[model samples]
Target: MKLYTEDPERILIYGGSRKDSGEIRGIISGDTLKGSFYYSSYGGGTLKRYPVAMLKRENKWLLGKGVISIYMGIPSYLKTEPIDYSDPKFIFEEVKK
Candidate 1:
């Protein structure tokens, strides 16, 4: 998977087989990005569209588990749920040019 952002508040996650990717958008509260991610992958699974709470660790962003709820017919992570940074997903770093 790969992560890039036009705005830190809005991030894009792309990867998987074929042409499947996801988007992340939320509030950046301190070192964590409390928001939602939408995705659907055929190689990874049938469908996976849900909310996410990624904690920005030292040098990596961690994908944490949280309680997912539906709002307005769309699945989302409850604002009350605190995303834990126990599970981190691989990201990257850019060397200054």
Candidate 2:
């Protein structure tokens, strides 16, 4: 799938960390969003990737938003990545298929 991260400025995590580009990646899943990413600590051993939600948020990353919260909190050390907003290639191939 071809997912594009929302405008970094518009897409803020817990505090307001301006996310970087390329943090975005695309993948395909079932009825719901699904994927995995790495959460790293200062220590090398702490670096490990795990499954994360591939959903969308109404405003910003918040637990109340469910999957969407997963979409917006890419830099929260949760190691989440922003889901692509919209695109024929991404929507048709990735989301809808």
Candidate 3:
């Protein structure tokens, strides 16, 4: 298991502090949305890369939880498995280009 310092309450996507900021790069596989997100600190700073996984339910992309770590100096994205739509704090929408 990889160790991470991310608190779900501090994620920006959930109206929390700017604790997470990263490039929206993901692929929709079946009902699973696999993507790569990064976390920041104190509103702004060096962005650390991590993984992100969301579940598509009823045409809505909901957020999930995953691990955070750095191995071999590679940007590891967040890996989320399971859909928790019980009371989601953040729902990923279509990124306007």
For this target, which candidate reaches the highest TM-score against the unseen true structure? 1
Better TM-score candidate (1, 2): 1
For model 2, the stretches where C-alpha displacement exceeds 4 angstroms are 1-32, 59-97
Expressed as tens digits, the lDDT of each residue in 1-97 for candidate 1 is 5554444322343454344445665789888776666655533555556666767666777777767787777787777867666655544443232
Cα deviation of 34, candidate 1, in Å = 1.6
lDDT over C-alpha atoms for residue 75 of model 2: 31
Q: Candidate 3's error at 18, in angstroms? A: 4.0
Model 2 C-alpha lDDT per residue in residues 10-82, reported as the tens digit of each score = 1113223332222323354543444444433322344444443443444222111122333454332232544
Error of 2 at 11 (Å): 13
Note the residue pairs that clash in candidate 3. 50-77, 50-78, 51-77, 51-78, 52-78
Could you tell me the C-alpha RMSD of candidate 2 in Å? 12.5
TM per candidate: 0.58, 0.28, 0.50
Cα TM-score of candidate 3 = 0.50
